[model samples]
Target: MGLHGEELTFGVEEEFFLVDASGQLVPRGPELVFGTEERGGELQQELIRSQVETATDVCRTAEEVLGHLTRMRADLAASAAERGLRLLPSGTPLLPKSSHEITQKERYREMADRFGAIARSSATCGCHVHVEVADRETAVRVSNHTRAWLPVLLALTANSPFSGGAVTGYRSWRHVLWSRWPSAGPPPMFVSLEHYENSVAAMLRSGAMMDRAMLYWDVRLSDNQPTLEFRICDVAATPEEATLAAVLIRGLVNVALRDVADARTPVIVPDEVLRANLWRAARDGLNGSCLHPESGELVPVWAVLDELMAGLRDALRTTGDLEFAEGMLARLRSTGGGGDRQLAAYRTRNRVTDVVDELCV
Candidate 1:
């Protein structure tokens, strides 16, 4: 019953793929970070040898978000390049040369063993944005309201449209692949935090999950942190795009909090409808259309996002993030999502390497 409204804050986590000079996926993992540090490199707390995660300090204003994100991305790119690697933003980096090339971390190894090919196939990159709430109640409320907006986020961020040496059909094959795990998918709507916790507890007791974090819902409460995490986005093709995504996610949370506080009950579509919307986002990416939350009628995905932005303009102004949000949407509309670029690159070059080059550069 913890639905008390609260002011919002922000955090960001960006997962990047390591690429060689030729723009091929490199299994450098966190070993790259370690190797760099051993050689007087300057990154820390990375997730794997080939992948590094950057987390921003909690931010209050959108300016602070932009400032911190820009600095972090530049630093990470510089450090990674010094070690003969580049960071590519994508969901999965065309699968490794072999599954054995997975990250060397024990946890990663165990994940591969437990999840089998699904884990091995998860050489994906993503950007996860966290918005802070005053308490668990507000967090739950934001989470509930937030799910309906996720497919649009996915459509905006669509970047991974291919896998291995073949076209994967769906714009974000990684979303489908990532959902292969038993616990992966949208979270069911629960009436209270207690109900949510009980569901997680039942999964844990049944030996289906390791902990709360592994629930792997499109959006969920961070068990170890005081925020709701949205993981529906693909890794962006550029640091600027990633920053834009972080800004939009932060803005959405503030708007959701305001709506809840003002007695505007959140409108979430049925789970099945949401699933269909997500599939449409993956299949069509930016070129695809989605169902409107209220009318259940098909609307151009970008048009729906435009309406959402217009609706949230007041909240954006109140949070002083309106310009940043608008600017980001402009870029998304012009450049399209990651999957759009990948498709374009594939059209011209007829090679996945070309797509990787487009992704990194």
Candidate 2:
């Protein structure tokens, strides 16, 4: 909560893999612990020592996100160098490995204890951005309204073109891999926060979930904060991409909040329709059409994003970031994404090794 209760803020969590100098993802988690934890700036262990997550404190503006992410990246890069570790971003490994190891943290241990094989199979990395709402009610409202747009966001930020050491044939295989969990995918629409809580309580009573956090919906209201969290994106390979995605998320939340306040009708696609759109986005990226959440008609990826920006321009302007949003949109068009970059690098170097080098570099 900031002044006027009208503050639009952003917070992000990114997961990365610890790779060796030879550009291979090491399965040894505990061995990389010192290099990562010793850096000391919001660096935290993830489900395994081979994985690490770094987060930024709540920031009220896009520029602040840029500053924090830049500093965090620098810190992690330095820390990884000190201990013979490297950080790389991809949804999963293409090469495949033995055993899905969970980090030794109590929380994670509980996850494995509760979810069995689902928890063990969770080796994907992602980026979750938090956008502040006025209250829990608005958090639920925004989460519902934003569901139709989640797939678009996922598509735009698609960066996991490669897993282990091969092309995954999808722009975002992480989404599919994560969907295998018991409590994952797009959340059911709820009329109110109480309805959501009741559903969650029922899950707890039945032992279906360890707690609310396990919901793992692509979009959901955070239990401990007055914000809606968008967890559908892959960990961006570049700071510019991360910041751009954060700005777009902030703008989307603003658009939803305004619609909620004005009692405006939101074009919500059914859960099934939304799921179809997600599958399309994962398969096609910006190269094809996605099923519209409500209309069920195929829509171009860039068209959907452009329309979203148009609807939220006033909100972006209010945040004094209209230019920032436009700049990012242009970059997205010009640079494509990690997927495009990886494809290009592969063509030039003729190997997945070169693609990973380009991504990690």
What's the alpha carbon RMSD for model 1? Answer: 3.3
Q: How many angstroms is residue 26 displaced in model 1 relative to the true structure, after the best TM-score fit?
A: 2.2
Worst 10 residues of 2 by lDDT: 32-41
Looking at candidate 2, what is the lDDT of residue 110? 90
lDDT (CA) for every model shown? 0.74, 0.76
> Model 2: per-residue lDDT, tens digit, 74-185?
7776667777766677666434453357777798999888777777777778988988874887788777778888888888877777665767788888887888876678
Could you estimate the TM-score for every candidate? 0.90, 0.92
Which has the greatest TM-score? 2
Worst 10 residues of 1 by lDDT: 38-47
Candidate 2 whole-model C-alpha lDDT, 0 to 1: 0.76
The model with the greatest lDDT is 2
lDDT tens digits, residue span 1-361, model 1: 1124334677777777777887666666566555543311124433334566667788777677667766766666676788787877777766446222666657667766777776665666677888776577667777887788888888888878877768889888878877777777777776888988888899879756665657888888887778888898887777677777776787788777767777677786898998888888878887689887778888898888888788777767766778877887777778777788888888896877777776673
